[model samples]
Target chain A: MSQLNAAARAPLDSRAKMIEFHEVHKYYGDYHALRGISATIREGEFFSLLGPSGCGKTTLLRTIAGFEDISSGAVLIDGKDMSDVAPNKRPTNMVFQSYAIFPHLTVGENVGFGLRRDPRSKAEKAKAVEEALEMVGLKGYGARAAHALSGGQRQRVALARALILKPKVLLLDEPLSALDKKIREQMQVELIKLQREVGITFVLVTHDQEEALVMSDRIAVMFEGEIAQLADPETLYRRPNSRRVADFIGVMNFLPAQILGEAAGHVQLEVGGLGRFEVTEEQASARASGAEPVVGFRPETLTILYEGQQAHDREAPATIDEVVYYGDMTYYDVKLDGVDAPVRISMRNVFGRPVLDVGTRTRVAWSAGALVLFR
Target chain B: MKFSSLKGYAFLYLVFLYAPIVLLPVFAFNSGTIIAFPLKGFTLDWFRDLFANQTLGLALKNSLIIAVSTSILSTTLGVFAARASTRFKFPGKTGVMGLIMLPLVLPEIIIASSLLVVLLAVGMPLSLFTVILGHTLMATPYAIAVLNAAFSSLDRSLEEAAYDLGETKWSTFRLIILPLVTPGIISSALMSFTISLDEFIVAFSLAGKETTLPIYIFSQLRFPKQIPMIMALGTCLVVASIVLLATAEYFRRRGLAKTGAKDTGGFL
Candidate 1:
């Protein structure tokens, strides 16, 4: 965790660019698949392209692997032009979504397939294959038929096969989408650990927001063939640049607000139910949705006040409209005294505390610093 | 009791289909020259006569040559057509594939007559080569049908993965694709060989001088002395067909098992 944090905190200028897409655009006949995508993936960083399906995240990743040609602009890898290079000639490898292990080959043969052109001796290549299998926790599984392995095992074999080549960049296209929930989570952690151990630049494409947050050092959230926002996970979750981005990343409650004025470094706003408050300019996203101004805050940021509990920054009186009980937390849809619609508030279930029921009058604690003003 | 009538119908259907084949071996071993039901003492004279016939031997050679050439040519053409149809999209793709597969539905006599006219108009000599050409035209559509199933069932990502893992397109096809589809290729070749061996109309229409096995069998049907020898030959063909079909099914099942793919119906 410390190592991951340190990597995340490292300054952008400290690392060299591994992949650079300069205004890359791709068109499939009349349909625009990638629209002027321009981003640089730094060396050894665990980067992710995240969005819902058909957002062209996978298409952008394929441009790096030379599987798809861009309509215009350039994609450079390691400071060199890669437009003319074929997938086999490029210094990158991919773990396909289907985990395309060769059904006719054994596990070891599949892992060692890329070494056919290498100048190493047969015994040395065999040793390398064994080591690669062991690295993915599949020791002594080299001789087994690849088709007989389980889904998780096939994923491991694919990883070992790609990693054995020691390419400059590793591309993964929703590699965990096929596995069940439990195995998917386990593989996510294992992938992070593997990425850190190798220190190779890993570019992952996924639609799962939580998986991206838990695995990526920095994420590029895309929508409609365009990147909406690119930032660290914390920044993306806390300060999404647009309402659409905010809604896509996680649950954020939006309430109507009137922007009074801007003075000094703070913008004062009259929130419909929470009353007037001032927030810094950094808390306001500059891109407007052309809709009315609204104040957005996460569910966990609002806490339902208990008996004798003091409000930290500010307080609002509300009536519980609904209650959803989870083992670790309880979510309440509370209608503020003056607001027409209910906003969800999530509260941790502490020991010996009674579960609140619907229709109960309560006071909810909130802070102005936790809110984001979206124009 | 509800299914008793259905069971009897099925039994009758099977016997109707197989009873003639059973009669082939029964008459083959009977000593009587007449094909009537009264059985004489067992004798191998008809089998000896079948082996000693030189015209039959020549016809068998010609048929083998045609069948082997037809199988190789048709299967090679099938691979190209199947790969093209499955892995690409171009203008008139459906129409083009439909035209290529049109021979499967066209009557063999029509094909034979049209091909005979075309060959004569072009001043091409009719021989075993002509017979092979006609048989390949008739058999390629079936080959492609079998190969299309094999190629389409294959996941496209498998090829991409091989190419991504430092393999050129040709090498990937050779090392990854060829082995996976070997059973389909075998099935296709056997199908073409069987079609060519038993085909009569095209061979009769195109072969000006050379005679294939089917033409020989048809010619021998008029003579009473050669009837038992034809039965002996028929017995050999039946056994050969069973062995061939069983071998193909074995390979097909093995391929399916190797790939962990579900067995979706096969020749067996």
Candidate 2:
């Protein structure tokens, strides 16, 4: 576990860093948009900026595309400072959220718009447009009017248009937000495959956590114009460095805990519901929030031990306060003995397993390794 | 019975509004000079008289020149103002846009008098050029109103997308913004032309020797024999106005359809 922690913490040395933000700050008059953002995006990696709206995720993405000028710091693409670069001069293309398909042009003309300055012959440009259309699964759609396409098809056209230029970096600004849910899910998977095939560094800005987790190799979770945590999807989900990141990534149950003391490389803590337990240094997060210190655990970390089942770790007595029955799983709000508030637990409903009713007594099993202490 | 009376009221209101205008061409085509009740035999003599009048022809040429110049100048200025207001954020933007749009609601007499005063104070000679300047000032607010609708409805990402696809700012505006807003430009030009052509107060206040059609028609109203020719000219203007307004409305509707935007009510 310590080796995995060190491995995750160490600087990435294998792959080339394709983009870097060095203390980049952006201000819109009196409003500070991006605050000292510094990170390295690796080559050919699917990176995402995940945050709530107005958290500067889109601002950071625009800085790379040169659509927005940073007020203070430098944005380096391929290790070159891009302070004076114009958007058209930058080696980046963006798939805008609105798709921005030129309504006046046909699909072919829209895709070939970037090649106007190229010295290629007419037939070659036409063939290039055809190949780009086919790459985005929109074959034979070149002659169609751009405005006549459906929402998803317009998105595919936007992708083809941006990718036709073969830019070094592809920036996507909430590209799937305009699509319906079913299509959005499908396009998320397709975007990942497309990124792999193109081998260009992709920077995606999205507010949806599930989309970020599903499509990105690493995510920088931002809040209030600053990145709260930058890690892989697994680390971001399991060991979120801050309480806000833990709450943003997924569902986590936080219970107040009293920090007893710190010993040699370990911290002893007393949890409200599960009594005293010693947590390792890596399991603890040093966020000095003014509120009370708490211990957080994912819903799946706590389990309901049924009859004839033995716990792999410690067991606590609890009563099922509420039951929410999903098709494949059942969620229970279980209140442990002497704990005032109920903590949520998710149990899978395999065949022949009866769901426990509300107000029923049960034994809840949890492991100390899965707990994250917030101080 | 109440609903029937209300419908009758609406019918009577429309007839009251259109009755005088409908009579203009009726007398214009009448052979008899007296414009009273009884219908006279139809003749092409009054239309023939309008062509032989040299001063009226000169006035017509002057109005055309002033209208065309005003339309181009006002619409060009409208495009700049509308683009700036919609696509950017500057200090005191609302105040700047409000001042530019003030001519729409300002009384035409006040605008004419102030412009005449300013021009004479600056020692500028009053000619068709001064009248064109005055007409452009009067018509630009309307041009901006129509053009604001054009530019504000445009998705800003379209320009960014063009820039992202390796096009410079000038090419993006030329290829994308110019084509998309062509209908708005046409609509604004037509509106300004119509307004400038029929404008009497500014032309009267600004034009020293270059008499516009309206002023010439007003001066000729004193001669009873020239009344029929003036009515004939009014008939032509009425038809031309309807055609111009219809064409403008068509372009506006086509613009809405091309952009796939929801149709709010238009000028027509």
Candidate 3:
């Protein structure tokens, strides 16, 4: 971790500093669209810019692709500055959210368009185009006009068009945002495989938390034009450094906690209003220097136990308000005394068992290690 | 839908507008020299006479020269103006665009007469050059209107993707934008030609020594003996105009269809 920390400070020390945005600011006349955005994407990494809408993820992608210019700072490609380079001149291509498939051209022509300028023979271009189509699993779709294809087919064409160029970096602006739920799920799996097959830097911009979590090597959660947190999916979800990052990742329940005592790597916290409790060590060390902080825990960390189980350590006697079956997992909306709202809890479903009905009095227990404290 | 009296009146109005020009060819083919109510047997004599008239022939040449030049020039300027207006923004763009499109609503007589005064003050002679200038100015707005629609309907991302793929702005336009809008350009060229060919008032005001086919035909109307020949000339011109106009309309419709738009809105 210390070596990793030193390496991160020296960006040039890594061979994988594929695209780096430095002090990037963008303005559209009056509106400050992006303010001082800085992030680095490593080579062969499937990185996601995860944020709410209007958080400037798409703008950042566009800027990297050269469709948009940054008002201040530089966008470096592989280490060189790309301040005035146009979109066509960049070593990046984008699979636009709309898929942006040319309606007038056939799928082959659309994919072959970028390769037309290549120093390859006509046969070579044709072979490349064919290979691109095959990669997208749309073999023989070359002759079909873009508009004639289905939504998924269009997406494939879009992917093929961007990927055929063998651009150093491929930007996906919410690529899965347009598809239906089932198709989106399928595409995500296909995208993961495709990313591995290509082994190119893939910078995807999306607002969907689960999409980012499942698909990214690193996820940057943005809020109001700045990165709230940048980490691997697990670390981003479980060890978020800020309250905003915790709230944005998953269904997290936060409660105000006061630190009774503090040390270098430990702190004591009084969390529950009705029943006082103290949590220490790693969780406490994750909080800010002061005592005024918030305690956050994901739903999966909480477990609802039966009434027969005596009130033991790490058990919160919370009554179930509602139960929602999520196929693989069951989500319970629990209302504990002294808590502001119904705290959510998720439990893996066991097959061939009596279900936990709603309005049941049950005690829920979560491992103290799973809880994260934030300022 | 049931037809009504107003529909009957509208149908009559359409016939009234077109009947004389339509009948011109019928009478030109008539064997008799006198154009009267009586039906005469068909002959090709007047058509031959129409081709033989040396002065009329010269006028036809001059009109063709002026119209073709004007069409080419108009379409070129129209392409630039339309592309700029539709695809970009600088400053005072709307005002400049409104000014370019203003001639569509302004009366042609007023425009022609105004050009006469402006050209005379500028020391330009009333000739084919003057006629070409006036026709080009009048026809350009129409060209812009047609091409503007063609350009704006274009998917902007196509060009951006081209740029993203490493093509410069100029190359992107030359390779991508030009191909997409070529149909509109072809239609605009044809439409401008037809309008210039059919134009008379502007030619009359600006073409002093060098009279066009329309002014020549109008001047010949006073001579009683040339009536049959003029009728023949009119018949030929009417036919040619119909063919040109139809060709222009066909290209325009084809252009619109190419861009996936159903409406064939055009200047002519």
Candidate 4:
């Protein structure tokens, strides 16, 4: 939870900036890969470009690594324009999605490859390579053939190889997508600790939203070569500026609502099945494109109040339609007495709490503060 | 084992393929000059005669020069062609590569005659150098085919990774690309060498006054007494070809194993 709080903190403008994209536009023939992107990543921040495939997340990361040339606009690294910099001369390294370990070299040789141009003595360079390997938890693995390592070991080798150079920024392109679920989760925590220890700006490109939420200090959610929403993990999930951003980051239940009236910072809406409620300006976000007005609530925000239990803010009678049992939680789809469709509600399965059966009558408790009006 | 007819057909097919090759060594050691089924007493007289013949010696020298030059020239050109075809997109790519590989399926005599006509029309003298040029044009396709497999299987990210780690484009190629595809280069060179050494139509048509081994062997066929000597030369060629091709195949497999790529059947 503390880690989550750290990830949810915003980077202030007072901090030094590491990378800045000024109206970056990239075109591959007729296809526009990145369209007029302008954003600044602060120094020592764990930033993420989160999106689905073909959303230009990886393409944006490549621009930072100098692997891709922007058709128009400038890319500035530490206040220096990089329009003419070749990838080799740029002060950045990337961990490829495939963990591109050189098959012909030993692990030690691969990690020391970037040191070929370093003016340091051979002994000093070797020591630095060993230190890098030890940092990645692959100590004493230098003599092993690179191709013979397991997939997780190969990923560590890739990390060590890139970090030994101590570049100004480290770019990771889906580095953990190739690992199994358990290892993927473990690596996510390890990567955060490593970033903190190294104090280098990390730019990660990932399609997994939860991974972004768990690791990034600030996340830029992209769609169709445009940033749909850029905010901290908490703000992006709780106060998404558009309906599309809400749907992409997490699950949200939506019901048809009629806009009763609107004021400067308050919106009065009569929501279907759940009755009427007044939402503030911060809660009434605009809908992307022209869609019907609706009020949305997260599954966990609506609780099934047991018999004789008092409502927290508002109460509605409903019958259980379906129940899904997870190990630590239970999800129930309940149809309110006047509602036409069933709405889902998740509850923590505490010890001795009854798991309600289908068709059971129950009272749902909800609050106006949890509602988001998408109009 | 139950399909007796199929088994017999396979046996017949093998004999049809290797029967002529088996006769080369048989006649090479025979002392008889006349072509007959019964073998004469064993003797190395024809082999001795083959060593002493001045014209055969000259033909051997010309063949070596042509084979070495053709292999080097074609493989170098093939490396460039293969790298371009795999790594970049250009207009008319397929058309250009198709034209380069056209000679592989084209009849050898047609290519030889057309090349001779064009060279003479341009007032270029035909010599061992002309033979070398003809052989190189024909052998380039095989070299490209082998090298293309090598380059296409290589991961593009490997080069990018090297560049990201501060190596220049040329050093990236020399350090990573070259070593990864070395086996392929070796295989391509051997293939070009083998093809140019045994080629007959191009050498026969384009060679002027300088006889390659194949041309010399054809001219000797008119004398009945020289048949055994020619058989000795054929036996030697077969052995050399087998050794060369086997080496090429070994290197090809080593390349696949090193890259951890699957073996799609090759020239062997």
- Best-performing candidate as measured by lDDT: 1
Error of 3 at A109 (Å): 3.0
Instruction: Give lDDT tens digits, candidate 4, residues A1-375.
Output: 225536434545667888999999999999999998999998888899999899999999999889899999999999899999999988899999999999988899999999999999999999998999999999999988888898889999999999999988999999999999999988898899888888888999999999999999889999999998888888888888788888888788878889889888899888766787789988887574456887778899999998788997998889999999997999999998888789989999999789999999999999989988788
Cα interface RMSD of each candidate: 0.9, 1.3, 2.1, 1.2
Ranking of all predicted structures according to TM-score, beginning with the best and ending with the worst = 1, 4, 2, 3
Residue A92 of model 2 has an lDDT of 91
The per-model DockQ list reads 0.83, 0.70, 0.42, 0.71
- Tens digit of lDDT per residue, candidate 3, span A1-375? 112212223232354799998999999898888889888888877889999999988888888998788899899998889987767778899888878776667789988888867999999899999999999999988887666787888899999999999989999999998899999988888888788778888999999999998788788889887887888888888888877777778888877777677766666677772244555565654544345787888888777776565534577667778889989988888888667578888888878644688877777776666778775
What TM-score should be assigned to candidate 3?
Answer: 0.86
Candidate 1 vs candidate 2, DockQ winner: 1
| Model 2, docking class | medium
TM-score of 4: 0.95
**Each prediction's number of clashing residue pairs:** 0, 0, 6, 0
Highest DockQ against the true fold, candidate: 1
Tell me the deviation in Å of residue A125 in model 4.
2.0
The C-alpha TM-scores of every prediction are: 0.98, 0.95, 0.86, 0.95
- Is candidate 3 or 4 superior in DockQ? 4
Interface RMSD of 4: 1.2
Best by TM-score: 1
Candidate 3, position A156, lDDT = 91
Off by over 4 Å in 1: A1-10, A286-290, B1-3
